[model samples]
Target: MAAPGTLRRFLATAWLITRKDITVEWRSREIIYTTVFFAASCILVFAFGFVKDGRPIDDVASAILWIAIAFSGTLALGRTFERERYNETLQALMLAPADRPAIYAGKLAGILLLMLAVEAVLVPLVALLFQAPLFRQPVLLVALLGSGTLGYAAVGTLFAAMLVRARSRDVLLPVLLYPITIPVIIAGVRGTAAAMAPDGGEMARAWVSMLVFFDVVFLTLSLWTFEAVMTE
Candidate 1:
């Protein structure tokens, strides 16, 4: 067992990395804006192409929403590590005075925060554009989305680190990430759609539990495997 101070220091290092990533993002504001734009475009395309049949947009709203998130989220993940790779900062991070899991946690936190921010902009935009009832059960929806996003971000961050050294770094993250993330995405969409139903709270709760289970399981697995992945 680690000492209390040792654990605290580890957490502090993780927090520092998380803050650094957010600070860099705040300076540029590029990733959030790009994600929002991509998300908006997805909404517009789906609205034009699929909403013409006078069908309830809610029918496909969940799919549309998650797909937008997944696609745009991939862009954000790819760019997350690009700057470090470009500037050779990753090597410096690897040499920092902290355990490797701390670095992984920080990167995961950063990616998760970015995803949440995009979702913040996305949910309202989606609701307004499609007239979907996303806001009907905000609390449950948020809980479910948060869990699912964290799971996705966990795997995404690890893969980002892995691909940073690859020749096809940009192409590799999603190719490796998306297939693994499908279950989380499905659970998320189902949960969101259930939350939209008249009395879907029960179903939503079940999905939220599933999301939490997925998050915990994968987060632990990712943490344990991160050192190996990063060193390779």
Candidate 2:
């Protein structure tokens, strides 16, 4: 077991990092607005292009929703760390005496909160625009969204940190992120689609379970590799 003082320091460090990122974000408000607007526009474009004869397919709604989230999330993750890289704050943070994993956790929490905020609006907009009966499977929808977002953020945070100093980070974030996160994305779309289906309860449960499993695994992997990647 860790000593009380050590535990307190760890928690305090994590909180301070989170608070710092939040404070920065609150001041600028750039990422929140950009991510939300980008996601909303994607949803509107899909609605316009795919809503056939004044009606959209229920099956397509889930796919569209996840796609919007994925794209916006990629953009948000990249920018979150890019700010640190540009300002040279990431190196300063690394040079601090705080725990490295705490820095990773703080960053992960900040990015996750931003993405969730974006999802909060985007989910309902997709439902409204596509006429999806999303509320019918409230539990399933919440489970899939939470797990999918958690897993995506976990991996995205690590990769974004790694690519922070890269020249082509804007293009590379998605290229590296998507291939690894395909399982989470697949589970998200499948779980969402199943929830929308009339007899897809069992399948939805399976996909949600897979999402949860993936979240645990990927988050563990991120935490394990974060310090090495950040220091290298």
Candidate 3:
């Protein structure tokens, strides 16, 4: 239904937005530093609490990892939007002569990258602290993690952008985000657990498939609705 050249323009616009976000973030390091530090703190606290009971960290490692990402990622998403709002850049973006979907894609990409970086640090720390066999199937774990992260970022970016102009946005962001993202978190934790199991290949595959489905459904929906949501 769209012109052929539309896609190219959309992509170019998206790339520009992504580049701008990354450039600003690289200079300040505020989002990254806060996200990683919060995530690492969560991991350490959980590690200490769980060890008091002499519980096997492996059993709960997957849940802990997802928890770290969910909370830290939420924080990072809020900060990303706030930065744009504070600089009045979001208004500038809205007036630009680019497809709205491109803007959404760029925001999603930026937030997703931040979340993934947080995960990278958290995952290694989780493995080191909990002695999880996370690297046993590094590719599988990464795939599972990526799918879950993508799904979260897709919905999170949409809600965050929509709420950026609202009062109590920080309060509302997690409240709305968590309800929608429960499935992704569940799939991630279960898939990670399955991947860690000796006979979990088949189970992990099933969960990853669900993660993929969630990613596709939410991502497409976000792309479709971003224009209306952002304009409203």
Candidate 4:
């Protein structure tokens, strides 16, 4: 595709990039399969390692859900950008006439969608394995997961892009991302736990609101700095 020539084409450019990533992944299915397996394995390990009387300890299910998300998300982010780096297409991508921030937005949107799809499977599995009532408040639960995952992905996409050319990015990605995303992780856990409770609507909504705000802040920062950050 040719480089975009006008600021008016920002969204179009972003969507084009997103479509490219999605099409590539659709052809290979490598990232999604590995991410799902890794996330499922994390849940299973937590289930077995932290069981009490053949059941996971109280509130452990929520924690496990977020932990699996964070871990597997980092894996997905690393590999997503790694493909560009490996193919030596990142420079070519950056050199395109499209807005750099639009590129970041495209990557963020694609990664966010992928994470949500993984969560759709992970959530049901966690409910079954841990006997948690994750779907009792389906609306609130989805809101929390969606907002929280957006916040997590907003930060992750930026860092993964920034570190794409680094030698130690695999090790460094989590090192940099986990600490920064602690608030997002905490909010996700709290909101999910609340949504699973019988009378926790108010609390769940509160956490979801906070997560939305965090998403806004993180995304704004990421988009604003993406151009300068990606500079050689």
Candidate 3 regions with alpha-carbon error over 4 angstroms:
1-3, 53-58
Could you tell me every candidate's TM-score relative to the true structure? 0.96, 0.95, 0.96, 0.95
Q: Could you give candidate 3's per-residue lDDT for residues 1-232 as a string of tens digits? A: 7787998898889989999989999999999999999999999999998765555544799999999999999999999999999978998999998888999999999999989888889988998888888887788898999999999999999999999999999999999999999999999999999999888988998999999999999999999999899886
Model 2 lDDT-worst window of ten: 49-58
All candidates in order of TM-score, best leading = 3, 1, 4, 2
Which lDDT tens digits does candidate 4 get at residues 131-162? 89999999998899999999999999999999
User: Model 4: how far is 65 from its true place, Å?
Assistant: 0.3
State candidate 3's TM-score.
Answer: 0.96
Each prediction's RMSD over C-alphas, in Å, is 1.3, 1.5, 1.3, 3.1
Query: Which segments of candidate 4 are over 4 A away from where they belong?
Result: 1-8
Judging by lDDT, tell me the better candidate of 2 and 3: 3
Best by TM-score: 3
Which pairs of residues clash in candidate 1, taking residues 3 or more apart in a chain or in different chains?
Answer: none
Q: lDDT tens digits, residues 122-226, model 2?
A: 989998999997777888998889899999999999999999989999989999999999999989998999998888889999999999999999988998899
Q: Residues 43-128, candidate 1, lDDT per residue (tens digit)?
A: 88888876766554446888888999899889888888988898989989998868999999998899899999999888887776
- In angstroms, the error of model 3 at 186 is 0.2
lDDT of each: 0.88, 0.91, 0.92, 0.92
Indicate whether candidate 1 or candidate 4 has the larger lDDT.
Answer: 4
